[model samples]
Target: MKVYISGLYSGTSPQPGIGLSRSLRIAYPDATLVGVEYSNRSSGIHWLGFDELWLQRPWEELDLPAYGQLITELLDGGALWISGTDLEALWLASVFPDGHANLLSPPAVGLSRITKPGVEAHKGLPLQIPPFVSTDHSDWDLHAFCRKHDWRVWLKGPYYEAVRTKSWDQFEAVRSALAKVWSTQRLFLQAHVSGYEESVMLAAYKGELLGCVSMRKRELTEDGKTWAGDVTEVPEAFAASLREIIRDINWSGGAELEMIKDPEGQRWLLEWNPRFPAWVHGATIAGCNLPAMLVEAATGIPAEKTTAQSEEFTRVVLEVPVRARYPLPPLPEPYAG
Candidate 1:
């Protein structure tokens, strides 16, 4: 079987494509692997031995007709595709209202409910949603809110970006900077929850929870992305709640629920990513291959639920020898007088 994976970049802030590609390779060594990316700067394009590489137009450059045509060409041979980034998956869902069999991604209808401003309204999840105020509300008392949280709060953009601010001045500065950078005023503030970080990674298909793995962050990059983690067992109650969530949304594909567990053991839902987390390959090494299970579920063969064996994973920088495989571009001819 052939597989197409997107988001193949790796760095301080890595993407999930390379991890998924590696996990899929471990499971199906002979299967054709195709790496899909939007930029030549994606480092994984050359390091990983993918059977094929496809570069496409950036997200903003493609319209519905163009995207539909791209999908048609990619899945022409009944190949399965798993989006490795949340934005691309959300965009695909928007463009293809009916969804595609060969594409594995969360349904668009339920995405908003699990994302930022909308997640606050999502009911039935066994977690606390931190109180937040949107910038659109000019009447909000910023000082009072900061004082309530003991001068600690997280400033967040509508889609992706967060900064922790402890004082009124810091809050305003961060708010202004994020607004300018993201080019929007739709920012929000959530009181910081003092706790340890953890994430639940799971795969679902047509409302059925196929498999899940819970892990706690042990090391993080400067940007707070997971750099090392250890797999932890899911409590039965927590597992049941996860099942209910999948069934409630009729979610299909992989997802990661990021949360913070406080000293009182209360879990606060921080974010719900529509696609797999970047550390998914760690789960593969720990004996739970979620990428493989996702592919299997998409193709009608449901794999058994998998739990990770007791294991830990960490990332380290490495250098690989680079060689030019394709012919180099011709040198410009000398200018004639």
Candidate 2:
């Protein structure tokens, strides 16, 4: 089987994509991985074992037709695209529909709900998001949210890139940077909710829960990505609440809810990941293998429940020398069911 994966760029690293490929290999040993890098400059293009590495069109150039043609080529090659980024996931959820149903990911509705404005509008609900405003209507109106929250606001791009801006000047700088990256998309101003970060990863189908695992971030880098973390228990109360939100949204695939625990011990939903998180390898090793589960669902194959591993995983940086190899056949998987 051929599986196409994207996320070649995940904030100064490509571990996210490589991690997915590694997980996929663990789940299905015989599967061939088709890595999609938006740029040839992506360093992970060197990480070994890709059956094929295709440089995809830049995100800014992906219109319906361009994206559709790309999909056709992939499907014709018998490759299933596993989204690496929310942008790609949204496009797949919107375009392919049943073709990629095994991903069991959120539909367009669920995807839309995770956006900055969507999170802002749903504040005070089960997730209790912090106050936020988009610059859609007016910049002046967004500043009001800053005054109301009186916190350092995060100037965020539509998909990625978030910069903490306490004053107007810094906001402008990040805004200008985002414009160059994600043109034609709106920028959002989010109230900085003070708290330590935690995340819950889940795999569900048709509004019913399969299983889930949660974690607390112990160490983080400047970009808010978890560097070191330990697996924690999933709170029963929080599980019940997250289930309701999933049912309400009719979510159909893997998702990660990033949260922040405030001084009062209340957790606010900082972000909703419609697809698997970058640290998903941690989840897979923990026994809640979302990639394997997703592949099972997508392929319509029945599989028994698997056990989880309890522990922590630290993100480590390393390098490998590329070696020359002749043309290779499809990758191998042990349980490519």
Task: Please tell me which predicted candidate would have the highest lDDT against the true structure.
Answer: 1
Residue pairs whose backbone atoms clash in candidate 1? none
TM-scores of the candidates are 0.87, 0.81
TM-score of 2: 0.81
Residue 269 error, candidate 2, Å? 1.0
Question: lDDT (CA) for every model shown?
Answer: 0.79, 0.70
lDDT string, candidate 2, 142-192, tens digits:
667777777478888765567888877777777888887777448888888
lDDT of 1 by residue, 1-337 (tens): 8888888878888888888887887767778888888866567777556888877767667575877687877666698888888778877788665567777887776586676844832466678888887877663576777788897789887656788988778888998899886778888888888889999999887778888989999998999999999986677887887788788777877888889999998889888888888999898879889888878877765444445554899988766544255333468999999
lDDT for residue 257 in candidate 1, whole number 0-100: 87
Q: Which ten residues in a row have the lowest lDDT in candidate 1?
A: 320-329
